[model samples]
Target: MDVSSTLVFAGIILVLLWLFSVNNSSKHRLPPGPRALPLIGNLPQIDSNAPFKSITKFSETYGPVVTLYVGRQRTVALFGYDVVKEALVDQGDDFTGREQLPFMLKATRGYGLGISNGERWRQLRRFTLTTLRDFGMGRKGMEEWIQEESQHLEAHIRSLKGQPFEPTFLLGCTVSNVICCLVFGERFNYEDKQFLRLLNIFTEFIRFNTSTMGQLYAIFPWFIERLPGHHHTVFAQMDEVREFIKKKIQEHKETLEPNSPRDYIDCFLIRMNQEKDNPSTEFIYDNLVSTVMNLFFAGTETTSTTMRYALSALIKYPEIQEKMRQEIDTVIGQNRCPNMEDRKSLPFTDAVIHEVQRFLDIVPFSVPRYTLKDISFRGYTIPKGTTILPMLHSVLREEKQWASPWSFKPEHFLDQNGNFKKNPAFLPFSAGKRNCVGESLARMELFLFLVSLLQHFTFSCSEGPDSINLVPEYSGFANMPRMHDIIATPR
Candidate 1:
């Protein structure tokens, strides 16, 4: 009953109460995941060398919804179609916000469609959809642009004359030009220095994104931003892209007539002026620059990489390539370029392209989403501000979704009667409101470009039959195939 004894007893009680509360809160908030060490959290559990593959393996052991604490934040990962669909489709708006990664936020300033969320996201996304539609995306005009670009790509490849050359540049050029046509109202010639420089910046940004320094920056941006490293180089590259977009915007503003919009930049400028006085307008110059940056960044690498894989896959499976060529010849012939409408009649070719996307599954884990409010799923509570990562690759390769998820079978997309069948689980572009804005354009480009090239030539491995490697090269952000030469001989 002495004063010192009373103080000691009170301290013990306080410690016990704090420990009890911590234990209970951790149990309810956290999902099933591997144990983490102090400070690093589950960083060591992640294989930085091959993050996607590592994450996929981790999901297998931890079930579909696995939580990992990285730095100060906890990320809830949803694997398989059922889980991803339920969160993205069944409960769309609840998980529409994006996790604010330090590096991305610094670079984008929480602008643009990719990383920005909430009201800004709504307005930008709606405007983008409207502008894209007005510009003829998913329509005949856009199809014509794709067909033209596909022919240009085919001609460039044909000029290579089956030599041992890298197709990366050609593919990037062709793919970027599609966006160029949309945004700038003109496509650049292959040798244009400005276009080449822009592509170089894009490549560097992608390369930097997959670097360890980039990962470090995301985890500890406060420390990394002050230090000198590849993060600076990455930021510089992003700035270069932004500058290019800004220059184009300036040009459009000076030349574009308000009464008639010529391209994406013009449309954006007009909207920016229209919303200048509005307090909640996200249509400012900075957002416009970043939006265009996102378009080129997302639009180019993904479609180009898929096309590269398409050719590589064709070389690996020559019989399938030959069959596709035969189908193209029978359906569209070689006199004219392949068009989007041709997709209906060319079921085999369509199936092959679909299989390419499914097999490759670009953007494996989609750009992360953050919960704006408390949400419950499968008896677990996902608290507000919790990060949700929809494992798109897992969904694409889910056993319940596809009969041969691991194999490259075009028949998975074909019916018994040999017609192209739509699979609900085919979500390479993702699902819900935040799905890829370029989905329609990307589809048209892939279908038209693949069919056009196949119509003109046959792709065969330059290496001996035994030396082909189907495993993709762990490139920057996207999963690119290993550098392999292919002979594109005239059919």
Candidate 2:
């Protein structure tokens, strides 16, 4: 253990790390990128606060399809509308693989539809979509559930009587209840402590997962796991959510009616029974628990977060809020409940909602895709096991696709006639084979809930519209809006 001996050991370690980087980098016809350092790779070049911006910057030098390393993980980021669409839409079969992010893998214990691949994914996705459709995910039954929840939401806000309140958990309760109706066949009262506690856990879990520490955990999980931080607590809280889902599943099993399924759980349980004889069937206890967790997690947060951000955007631009209200008043009137059928008639309102999603740019990195096998895309050989990121931020804000990509302009989604126009780049739900399974459900919830709120009340905060910041509080994993207190005055 002399000084020279220690120096020899350190030299050997650096050499091994250098060899590792060379093997990953120089082995294939990988897309061009900045020269990565050993072990840490291109992480030093990335901005922790806005990693998407850093990745987009790489495209400036490396072109639209660029390869870079995140710690030891090799990532291929697709930028701009053309590159992303070409990879995710044109050659979808190759780009359809979902990256089983370490945080999510640990959360779901590698069993849910969110991170599963191949047979498990195909079976669960198909069955889940079919069951949801049968139970009216995008249909009249689902719309009714959202409308009912909107009534509860309005009543809760009215109880405040224009007193300023933070809408974070309130919006969470409203949106989560809609999913509860679909998945658990019941919705809890807003005052239910257990339900409220679970919602709080979800908020923290997402915050941690999108934090710099969370990104670090994903990059160097082996090292980070050995150390200590909030990651452990996040996983433990996720277990609590899973336990809640398990309890609901057990209740559904007790009340099991083979002939008639009451909700998503009932439908899944019935399927489990039908597929019991098959050895390879994906319907089982683990898949059931994890898949329900997936539905609950995905269904609850994104739509609710979008609505929360929408309110902030409205407060930031009161003119937009007033315009939406004027349109809603004209199309549906104040007395009638908003429905999906009314979306077409309320074009300006629809455009505003669409603009909110585009402006918020949640899930900017979309869920990372993986290469199941070596493949040629855009003349680059993307090696097997490479993580692919079709940056939705790039598509949503690409200059070629959006006239004013950086601005909060509802006119982006409107024609000269002011009719709601469709833009190919408006991909808040993402696109391609692995796009969000809950897209239809989310769209229904956003349209109905927002319209219902505007129909009943006008949203504003105490600090005035000038003080409101439409920019997100956090921009990694998902763009999390900053929480604020706002008044909801009855119209």
Candidate 3:
């Protein structure tokens, strides 16, 4: 066949596939959603920039549980805390499947804990959780790690001498170094060129993933991959990060001590050997490399971005910042670094941090879940292979859940007695068995880093608080807070 003939053939194949998908979906009592086109599905209806907003709007018309298609992929989005909690928390196992988006598949090459399902996911997740806990993931040892890192962060800021600087990469360095200490067993210097390069890659990775082009790429990767665009550049940079991880694995192997495992890499290397003979063992070379990549990527970007947003939030609401500082001074004083033990004594400070996470709603759409098999949810049949989206944004911002769903109010997490209160709907880390593995660590970092920063410096931008917008610049894959150059004046 000539090129034109081949193109026609491919087009016909896609039509047939889309028709088959529609025919099957019609057979089942799928949830109601907006009308969709044949090949493109509901793309025309969606705001490509903020795809979740489109999904949320669909829920307003179709009720809480609604279905839509994105480039022929059927998706059922659960809105509100009740419905999302029922699916992800109530029927957790059925919603445990992680959708391996083409973007993630390309990033991990189909071999990581972040984008795997079934036995692979279970094995790696169990092992990862166990190993991380052993290395003090959410425990006292990790608290010390964060406390020490806080000092380093504070020192770096003090060296700035109150000059205005964008906190994006500097905060990335701070957060990434903590995960580096856990995974690689060492921290990178703030000025390391390669370290800075890796951090930039992570920032770009999040930026692209949250862009409109990135959304299109996820929905129609087969077509997008064939065409030239920014996606290619993002993927290439991702490969560089992956290659960097592989090199680190090699170094760990060379310096391995079976009896004295230095960090996560050493521990995994030891496990890989113990299971080298077992065919079913998930502890293998590819998994180790990919899981490390998963850890590095997840452990670095999300927490760092949250901290970045937290700084923006603080700058935007200096009153909240001052209140938190007062609480910090009273509870922990300025003599020593803030610790997790100080959280209870510092209720207002704790409330502000929790409120920050809740208001930001960073991961608005929890990593899309997949139905591994036919399942019944809310009297509807979610057919196997359908993507499930528990809209964390709706839950976090649900009118019925919060007194001020849209505003940044620390009192949302506070009681009439002025003690810190826990809200079931405050799911910034999400809720479920498949929720963020690094939740505890992220919490520790936010508290320690923010408290430490406020202890020494008052955050304000040159453009003034009025110029700082708490609204994220992008709102798709993640809610990315607008970046600003701000001064950290010595307190």
**Root-mean-square deviation per candidate:** 5.4, 1.6, 1.4
lDDT (tens digit, per residue) of candidate 1 on 441-489 = 9998888888888888877765654566767666323565677777788
Q: Mind giving the per-residue lDDT tens digits that candidate 2 earns over 1-491? A: 99999989997897697677668657789999998877788999999898998989999898999998898788899998888889988999998899989988988899979999999999999999998898899999889888889889999999999999999899999999988888998999999999999999889988987799988998989889988788889899999998998898999899899998899899888988899999999999999999998888888899999999999999889999999999899989999898899999999989999999998899999999999999898888999989999999998899999888999999999999988899988888888889999999999999999999999998888889988887888877888988888988888
Steric collisions counted per model: 0, 0, 0
Q: State the TM-score for model 2.
A: 0.97
Model 2 off-target regions past 4 Å? 1-18
Q: Comparing 1 and 2 by TM-score, which wins?
A: 2
Writing each residue's lDDT as its tens digit, candidate 3 over 139-198 gives 999989988888888899999999999999999999999999999999999999999999
Ranking by TM-score: 3, 2, 1
